[model samples]
Each structure stands twice: as structure tokens, then as C-alpha cells.
Target: MIKILLVGCNGKMGTMISTVAQNSTTLTIAAGFDSKTEGNFNYPVYDSLTNVKENVDVVLDFSRPATLDSICEFVLNRKIPVVFCTTGYSAEQLNKIQGLSAEVPVFHSANMSIGINIVNNILKTISNTLYKDFDIEIIEKHHNQKVDAPSGTALLLANTIKDSIEAETEFNYGREGIAKREHKEIGIHAIRGGNIIGDHEVIFAGKGEVIEIKHSAISREVFAVGALKACEYVYDKTPGMYSMDNVVNDTIKF
Candidate 1:
């Protein structure tokens, strides 16, 4: 069994992951770390990781970026693998995560949904073909409670297109001011409303046709399930950085 130290255990995603783990034969929540320590959990919840006593094989984090330093310190000291499911980390914090990967297994993904990762792969395959002729635009929708604008998944897809085409591309977030659209600019739009699980749409507009690829999450459980898959993938691996792409490649044949 993989014993996980779940960070942000009181949050929605944390609770979902816990519920999912309860049905898994190979997974268990050994302990939890959250500022709000009191909860209706089968496992003990501590206000800090330093207070955790249970032996854990991995750390699954869905907490805010503000907790990254403490989490990094804990994982480094323990030499345990960690899966980061939180979004909105700054470049410096992301660099810190990359640095941590050199010492222990670190899995990070902006959107931990299997379908999203597959879409990411598909973008890579088609970006080279459509980028030169097509004007790309990405639209992402999430719940009103979401703090980050232009969800990480949107940026991920934009970056995928940029990298695949091997060209300099600029991102335009929600255009205004009546400027003509630049040929090399990719448009990104964000929508916030009531209880949207998650939605992402990519528009590739060409001379005569527009190709739109979209992924809409029906429930938050998709992310929880993907994060758990990431947990299993990184559990016994050597020290390195991993992503949902790696997990998808390992599990999906085509």
C-alpha cells in the first residue's frame, strides 16, 4: 500500500482525493497537513507537517503556493516523493519545485486530469501543422472562487503550441483597445461563474476553417483520480521531475 501524507486535507480537492483513496486497495491516507486541523477524517490531521508522526510513502499536495517552502523542506528531509496538484505558482516557486526534483521524485501538473493531459499530447501533434496558418485562441472557464486568471491549463496549452512550432509567439489575454490582431499572438480568455468544474477550449482559425478542441470537466473527481495516478507513478521512482504526460505515456498505449 502507498501511504500518502495529504496536504490541504480539508479543501475540496483534498476531500475528493481522500474519498477516492478510500475505495483504492493500494492507497491510504496516513496523515494530513492543513491549517484547519479539525476534520472528519479517518486519518490524523495536523496543522503542520512537522507535527506529522505517521510513516508515509508519498506526499500529495493540493494546497496553496504559499505552503510550498514548508512542503519542500519536509519532503527534502524525508526523501519522500511528492505530487503537486496546486496551480498559480510563481516562476520562482516553480523553479524551487524544479530544484527539489533533483533530490526527490517530484510530480507537477497544472491540470491533473487524464483527459487534459491527452489533449496536451494531441496539441503537440497538431501544433506544427496548424500554427503557421491558424490563429490560435484559448478560453478557460472555472468557478468564481478560483483566484488565478487565465488558468494554468490555458497557459500550458499555449506553451505547448509555442514550443511545437519552434517560433516566437506572444499571448494576448482578453483583447481590447481595438488593435488589429497580430499574426503571432495567441489569444486567451478566462470566464468565471458559478460552480464550473473546469473548461478549456482551443480555437485554431485558418483561412477558411476553424478547428476547436475543448475539454470540460464534469466533476472534480477527474483531477483527484489523475493525481492518484501520478502518486502511483512516482511512488518508487528515482529522484526526478515527472508530469501527467509521463503518467499518461505509461498508461495509455495510443
Candidate 2:
């Protein structure tokens, strides 16, 4: 069995992951790290990684970016692989994550849904074929409680399209005042309200028509399931950085 040390175990995603692992045959929760340590769980929940009492094969992180420093130190010292499902990290924190990848297996992604990963791949193909004649715009919607705008999945889609076209594409996040759309710019818009799980739409607009590619997440299970798959993949991987694409290729077909 692969023993997973789940960070942010008391939060929504953490609880969801633990609930899923209860019926898992190959994966088990060995320990958890969270600020809220008062809870009834099959495994022990520590106030921090430094307080964990059991050995674990891997770490699954859904914690805040503020705790990243401590997380890096804990994993580096133990030589353990980690899957980061948290979003809204600054550029400096992202660089720190890249630096840690040189010493231990580090998996990070803007979105963990396998469906979204497949959408990323499809967008690449579509962007390459239509970018010359079409203006690309992305619309992403999430629950009001979500902390970040443009959703990480929106950026993932934008970057995927940017990579495929091999052009100097600038992202314009919601316009202000009066300005015409730039040819090489990708417009990204965000909507936050109600209890939307996730919804992303990429539109290709031309002179007379438009084409849209979309993916919608109905629940948090998709993310939890993807994180488990990432844990399984990174358990024995060599020191390096990985993404959802790597996990998808090894575990399932597009």
C-alpha cells in the first residue's frame, strides 16, 4: 500500500480525499498536517509536518501557499515525493517549488481534474489550427468562496494555447476604459457566484462565426481522485518536476 501524508487534512479538499481513501485498496492515509488538529480520523492529524508520528510514502498537499516553506523543508529532509494541489502561489513561491524539484519529485498543476487536463491538450490542437484567423478569449466561473480570480484552470488553458501557437501572446484580464482588442492578446474573464464547482470556456471568434471548447467540473471528487493518481505516479519517480499531463498519460487515456 502507498501511505500518503495528506496536508491540509482538516479542510474541504482534505476531508474529501480522506473520504475517498477510506475505500481505496492501494492507497492509505498514514498521517495528516493541518492547523486544525482537533478531529476524529483514522490517521493522526498533526499541527504541522514536524509533528507527524508515522512514516509515509508520499505527501499530498492541498494547503495554503504560506505553509510552502515548511512543506519544502519537511519533504527535503525526508526525501519524499509531493503533489501540490494548491493554487494562487506568487512567482517567487513558484520558483522555490521549481528549485525543490531538483532534489525530490515535485508535482504541481493549476487544476487536478483529468477532464481539464484533456481539455488542455485539445486546446493546444485547436489553437494551433485556428489562432491565425481567430481571436481567442477564455471565460472561467467558480464559486464565490474561491479566493483566486481567472481560476488556475483558465491560466492553464491560456498557457496551453500560448505554447501551441508559439507566439508572443499577452493575457488581458478583463478590460477597462475603451480599447480595441489586440490581435496577439488573449482575453481572460472570470465569474464568481453561487456554488459553481468549475466552468471553463475557450472561444475562437472570427469574422462571421465562433467556436467554443469547454469543460465543467460538477464536484470536488475529480480533483481528489486526480491527486491520488499523482501520488501513485510520483511515489517512485526520480527527482524532477511533473504535471497533470504526466499523470494522465501514465494512468489513463485521453
TM-scores of the models, in the given order?
0.98, 0.96
Spell out the clash pairs found in candidate 2: none
Candidate 1 per-residue lDDT, tens place, 21-95, comes to 999998899999999988899999999789899999999999999999999999999999999999999999999
For model 2 the TM-score comes to 0.96
- In terms of TM-score, which candidate is strongest? 1
lDDT of 1: 0.93
Worst 10-residue stretch by lDDT in candidate 1? 245-254
Give the lDDT of residue 226 in candidate 2.
Answer: 89
* Best model per lDDT: 1
Worst 10 residues of 2 by lDDT: 245-254
